[model samples]
Target: MRLIAFGESFVAGVGDPDHLGWVGRALAGRRAVTLYNLGVRGATSTKLASLWRREAEARLSDEEPCRIVFSFGVNDTWHAAGEARVTPAQSLLNARAMLTEAASLCPVLLVGPPPIPDAGRQARIEALNENFKLLCARLQVPFIDVFRPLAADGLWVCEAAAWDGAHPGAAGYQRMADLIAAHPLWRAFTLAE
Candidate 1:
């Protein structure tokens, strides 16, 4: 099986000293799988949507089962000077188009963006996540909401807070790995054929 995961820093496993972000930990030890992590730091949905299909198509092998995982959104909520990098409406369009295209290719899973300590940015992230969840539901793609849970998790918050207030360390990544690993949809996706 080939799994192509697309996202930003969290998908890249940015602050983990171990270098194995949640993607590495969650999918570790799976057999007969080729995993590609296409996590570009500071990538927004527009950036990802523009490039993902071509990249993923090139990597997928017709001889094997394939899966796609999309986890991103936090970057779009970022502010520069005074403007949101990617507006909420633009984010929705990107999410719909990206998830729809990816789902057409294979079984797809959508993981919501994680939380940060900044109240303003966090609020944006939370709202984006809600919109993403609804979009995923409409598209029939499995969606995992990491924002609410991770926001309240002491370990996740402390690790991320003490660091860049965005990325977390190993233990925090491990918590995310656990959450993702335990999700029922994730199990079903991995278990399928």
Candidate 2:
């Protein structure tokens, strides 16, 4: 299996001491799966949409089964001088475009943005998460609501707070991986014959 995880720093595993991030931890015991982590720091959904096809194409082949996992939005909701980096409407458009393209190529999983320490930013993230859920439902794609679960998780909150207020450490990443692993869609996708 060939898998591509494309998104922002959270997907890149920024704050983790081991640097595996959630992607590495999630794919750890999956035998024979070649996974590529194309997560970039500070990337928005628009940036990802612009770059994903070209990047994914380079690593994927027609002869093999390939899958894509997308996790972003926190950066999109980021405020710089009282202005958002990417507005919710634009973010949804970018996500739709990327998911449409990716679904045409192979299976796609959408992981909603995780929580941050700031209430204001987290509010934006929560709204974005809801929008993402609606979008995924319309497209019949599998969506993972990482924000809701992680927002309430003490370990995730503590680890993220201890570091950058956005990214988390190894324990938090493990928690994320566990969540993804337990999702019914994830199980079915990985265990399919």
Alpha-carbon runs more than 4 Å astray in model 1: none
Q: Which residue pairs clash within candidate 1?
A: none
Cα error, candidate 1, residue 8 (Å): 0.4
lDDT (Cα atoms) of all candidates against the true structure: 0.91, 0.90
Q: Best lDDT goes to which candidate?
A: 1
The RMSD (Cα, Å) of candidate 2 is 1.1
lDDT of 2 at 78: 86
Residues 109-137, candidate 2, lDDT per residue (tens digit)? Answer: 89999998889998999999999999999
For all the candidates, what are their Cα RMSDs to the real structure?
A: 1.2, 1.1
TM value for model 1? 0.97
Candidate 1, position 140, lDDT: 82
Tens-place lDDT digits, model 1, residues 8-56: 9999999999998999898878867788999999999999999999999
Number of backbone collisions per candidate: 0, 0
